[model samples]
Target: MELRNRSAFHEYFFETTYVAGIVLVGTEVKSLRAGKVSFNDAYCQFHKGELYVKNLHISDYAFGTTQRHEPTQERKLLLKKKELRKLEAKIKEKGYTIVPLKIFFNDRNLAKIEIGLGKGKKLYDKRETIKKRDVERDLKRYVK
Candidate 1:
């Protein structure tokens, strides 16, 4: 199953995207398969030369035992060293953020996340996007 953050497009303009592996406990993985995950407040942060994701909530498994993982924990993200360095440099600038766009299990059954380098949209930018979308919708409807 794939979980997507639809609001990402409305909230920010994505510059580049990369897929990264997420470190999850057994319970977390099980929960993800059941579609018990939320990206409402999750964001990627660079910490001590490594990248970590915070506020990514993976609900506890229904059949979890006493070792259930916390719902909201800082999960480490695995990315290549060169990519990490590149992201680090870009993020150090103002207004750029690393945001999770989606989460899905790859072919090998491992959880992977799609992250984007984004800059938040201003009020006018958001309004412009809305207007553009409205025009596109009208055009599509007329074509049909």
Candidate 2:
């Protein structure tokens, strides 16, 4: 199953994307397999030179024991040191942010997050995007 943060595109202009593995526990993995995830208000940030995703909610598994995983806990992202350093350097610049775009399992059945280096869009940019999307829809309808 794949879960996407649809709002990320509307809110940011992505420059580059990276696929990074996530550190998840047993219950969290089960929750992901069940497609119980929310990306609302989720973002990536560096803590002590390591990257972590915050506010990416993975609900507790229904059949879990008393000690269940927290729904909105911060989870570490696994990336190469070179990539991490590059991202950290870019983040130090102005207006650059790390946004989680989607979550999906790889061929090996490991959960991975696709993150993008993006700049937040302005209000006018968002309006233009909407107008363009509406025009595309109209064009497609006309073609059909």
Residues 1-144, candidate 2: write the lDDT tens digits: 899999999999999999999999769998998999999999999999999999999998999997689899999999999999999999999999999999999999999999999999999999999999999999999999
Global local distance difference test of model 1 = 0.93
Model 1: lDDT of residue 63: 94
**In model 2, where is the ten-residue run with the lowest total lDDT?**
25-34
lDDT value, candidate 2, whole model: 0.96
Off by over 4 Å in 1: none
Candidate 1: the clashing residue pairs are none
Per-residue lDDT, model 1, residue 84, is 99
Tens-place lDDT per residue, model 1, 1-144, is 899988889999999999999888768988888889888878999889999999888888989888799999999999999999999999999999999999999889889999999999999999999999999999999999
Off by over 4 Å in 2: none
Error of 1 at 85 (Å): 0.3
